[model samples]
Target chain A: MPPTPRRGASAVLLPRLGSLVVLIAGWQAAAWFAGSRLLPGPAAVAAGIGEALVHGEMAMHLSATLARVAAAFALAMAFGTSLGYAMGRSDRFDRVADPWLVLLLNLPALVVIVLAYVWFGLTEAAAVGAVALNKIPNTVVVVREGARALDPGLDEVARAYRFGTWKRLRHVVLPQLGPYLAAAARSGLSLVWKIVLVVELLGRSNGVGFEIGTYFQLFDVRMILAYALAFVVIMLLVETLVLQPVERRAGRWRQRHA
Target chain B: MLELDIRRKEYRGVSSPLLAVRDLKLCLEAGRFGAVLGESGCGKSTALRILAGLDPDYEGEVRRPGEGRLGIVFQEPRLLPWRTVEQNVRLALPQPLEGRDLAPLFASLGLAEHRDRHPGELSLGLARRAALARAFAVEPDLLLLDEPFVSLDPATAGRLRGELADLVARSRATTLMVTHDEEEALALADTVFVLSPRPARLLGEVTLDRPRGARDAGWVAERRREIERLRAG
Candidate 1:
């Protein structure tokens, strides 16, 4: 017989917790040998986290970082999906845009960020726009493949039924593209998070990246670890709570069919 | 009613333009059932696509009803795997069939219990029935079936063919089915147009004068021999 749902849940959860415990134990062992200032134990970092939370500094910096991530992710996904879909559908558009896409994809993220800062000044628009620009090419590539992989057999079904533009998009095109969209979202989120940190570290005044930079200057290792750990935890939560659920839902049809 | 006079259709092969269909002409009066019988890859499907207004690049004058709707059953089911069977059928309806009792249609197709199931959950026979259901749900003026029962087992194919004949009779839509199966063409169609291999042109057309219900296995066997004799000549 197959495992019951409750038993299955425990089977998945226990190993994850076991890995976390093992990682913390190793970190603590290393910290003890290195001593406190050079490398704090997990307990010292936990204390630093508690201090920052109590002072409300962690909340401000975390929220600021999250806001940047959200803005950049939305911008990249919207523009990239449209551009990619257009390029995929039309041969003329694809030919014209192909070289530019290749160039954008190969362009260094750091270079784009620096150029944005220099051209637009050290503003929020520059920071978010630069991060979005860096991430757009990846989203475009993923979504373009999705659009290209659309089944022509299904396209005939649409044409036979005389499906209008909206209906075709909803029933035929989008459902086929669901997996690719989910892929774009998942990769795009991870890419945007990393770039947003770089953007903040380079120019921003008040985010986890800026806080980490400040801690680095003072050589406050515990506070730096604390902020890093907190941000990691928050991102993990978003992945599990928001992104995974959406992906699972989008792909539920496949699971059921399989 | 439908009329097709396809002059030519060519595919860009590695070295030359491979012609698939040439000078293929046929006409079907309204409420008549017809089948284009040909070998696989003989452009039968390409001909159907032209009639259905899907392939406009061909040189042809296809005179179908100006404002009529089309319901096509592809060689494969071509169902949206993500949509439930009923959802797939509902999507093909020309207008919102609000408060409509689709249970009867599903029951007739032997799909009543599987309406909520996705297409992948069903067997090949059941999936074809779902495709048939989707086509009939629209009450289409022209119904196109491209080898609807080609890949099924013998018994399943026989049963589904019977169900299809019954549905087509009731709907009375001007139907055009393409099949390589001579038996299937003779069994279901009022008129059968035999087609040649590549650059498919009409070989001949046979109009079965006898009603479908009166034609049994013995009659079909006799007709098959007659068609073979005709082909030889």
Candidate 2:
């Protein structure tokens, strides 16, 4: 237990940073053996990233992808949470919506994207809609579980205190479901961002996915790696900056079991 | 004033429809404190729920002056575990504090220090105190408490009972409490309504003639015996 990790700046970062450095070194060595064309090294990819930012369409493509992710993530979470809460609280609603939920959850993402394009004629709405449609069912399932586990006694107290629908939702229901909503958001962000790529590749243009698709046809490995790496780094920043903070805030009331 | 006339209340059970309350009638005039004393599972809580408007399927009528305003303490401290103690109490008020200072209420209940703590961080006794604070925050015209003191150690229960008695006397809300503890009923209530076993009806009643201040231990013991005799008769 010499390296017993305590909560501090160094303790958390040291191990993760160590492993990541090792991974990059390993990849660099592999690239040297394979030659730069087949599997480019870290330096080549880094140079390619610098090149894209300086003289390429990286900004426009990155913004397009980011906007789609933000729009679709917000849309899915709002609609799914309401639907899930309704299903969880009402047996009749569950019965009516269960089959539909099952169908949507099992539907493949590629199929949804293709169907949306066919129906909407390859518009921006079609791309975001397809991505959100793929995501809504997952959010519904998680939030439904959260709603079902809610305490009946608390509901009684809310009713007795004469809390209006909106008040009860904010003070009573939302706090109870905060963790669930966070769970949905975390998963939805990952899913929506990845699917947005496939969506852009399939029908839409002017996104990271479209650029990657163009490079794939031209057989440009370095540019492809650069775009993919940049997107992954952006997502990592979001996970740290946005989602993690929200999850922590939502669980602030949890008591440590002695 | 508050009135309840629960002719019948039934629950859909496995074997058959289980009757929980029948022919149970209670009336507490404005500014009076009343207790319903009954055996365990004698449907006392069902009667209280009907009165609090928490249960709607009961076959009866409940008449109170204000329909929307209510203050209740359930058998368990049904606090929103995520909220701080003060937030739980404040949420029960007709408005957010209603422009009245709650510092006195918080101080008198010995919860001034613990007001910002969540219910999850509290012991049962402290949670019960928070529950009592919530019930009294509204200065409710009718206060319904369903065994608010159950499951606490005797010392904490007694302390809470004392604080409750003081608050009830000062607030003068028409209070109705349900409990199986006979002495507790005798100690605090102006009228203790004794109830029979299942599908409960009124077996008898013991009414105290003195104000709460004069009702010492000796007097409470005497009334307890009187209630026993009345129940036997």
Candidate 3:
């Protein structure tokens, strides 16, 4: 059954606390039964996380990974949105580039990462390039479809009235394309982070992914589990703090009008 | 002035052209309001589209005396959902229409309170009013409307038609509209052309020489008789 309506702050916190307790209990019981080699208990992983945080290993790696993801995400958004608009508006662009775009969309992230490393070298550029490449094609496909679906008669009206290019784009085109762009950004962010983590693990000597690899090599199960959990926590933070807020703001306009 | 002769259009894979307004000739003088009245699928919309320069696929001899700009309103409001009502009107303006100037336009249509609101927030009638404002704001040489009031209730449609007639009279824009309603065609147009269905052809023209305000029951009865004759043929 769905929980009853929570009327107070404490009522809201109750479920979260209950879920946490259940998770810790289950992990502790499993660790005691299996021993530490295969599955580190909650206490062991917490200790590893604490040790890494105090020594600055966790902070350094976390910041490096976050910075890379952030840069790649920004580049992806810039390229994808512009390219999507062009592809949507021009039949010539669609004819020439659509097949290539579809191929890129279907290409595996690993293959793109490998190709980028080979072409650009195993540097910061390569990692970011890999993530950006993986992200851009999907964004282009989604946003281009959005652009193509705009009403032709409305566009004709704009043209007949001699609306300047900027005015036409801003007032007529951008608003219609907002939701599609938002959806693409949301999905692109998730995919880029995951792909960036994998790319870091495969080659980079830094980042959360590299730290997890290091822990694996040393057979430190608790440290590996700690890094994985930390990454999950970061993903949740981004979803709640960044993406969800934008989604809600964009949707607010739609709701108010609808 | 605008003219079209022998316009023909067809989509692929059919036995014949979907629209063949053959030997169709129109000589619309500047600043006159004309209406095309016909049943559904009678190619009235196709003619309007050709005038608006949207359907370039048609073969036709077209002539316009000057750089005549046209603002076309389709059946739907077609306002960008993301834009506020003010922004939608602004789309029709060549430059940013000043807020003070826009206020009276909005007030005239009973939409002053909704200027900042998005199109999706508006009722169907209000949305149509915004669309009309968008068209009027353009200050076009010619305005083409394809059944712009088809979806509205009779009272609202009547009110909008009256408002539009006044706007056209005031602006002096050459207007060509397509509608199936005999009352609407007769009420708003200076000249209404009745058309036959399928291979659509012009039946005859009813010249409403009386000014818009003079339209009453007798005027409507005369138009009904004229439409009945066309339908019977």
lDDT of 2 by residue, B16-131 (tens): 99999999887777888899999989999999888888889988899974543677898899888888998888877776556567789989999999998889878999998899
- Model 1 ranges off by over 4 Å: A1-7, B96-99, B216-226
| DockQ per model, Cα | 0.78, 0.69, 0.58
Comparison by DockQ, 1 against 3, better one: 1
Residues A61-143, model 2: lDDT tens digits: 99899999999998999899999999999999999999999999999999999989998988999999999999999999999
List the candidate numbers ranked by DockQ, top first. 1, 2, 3
Q: Model 2 - which docking category?
A: medium
Error of 1 at B59 (Å): 0.6
- Model 3 off-target regions past 4 Å? A1-21, A81-102, A160-165, B13-17, B63-67, B96-100, B219-233
How many Å off is the CA of B131 in candidate 2? 1.1
Question: Residues A1-258, candidate 3, lDDT per residue (tens digit)?
Answer: 243454998887899999999988998999999985869889888888888899858988988888998999999988998999899999999889999998998999999999989988999999998899899998898989999998786687676667788888877787678789889878887788888888899889999889888888898888888887877788779988988898777666666633
TM-scores, in order shown?
A: 0.95, 0.96, 0.87
> Highest TM-score: which candidate?
2
**Which 10 successive residues of model 1 chain A have the least lDDT summed?**
A1-10
Q: Could you give me the TM-score of model 1 versus the true structure?
A: 0.95
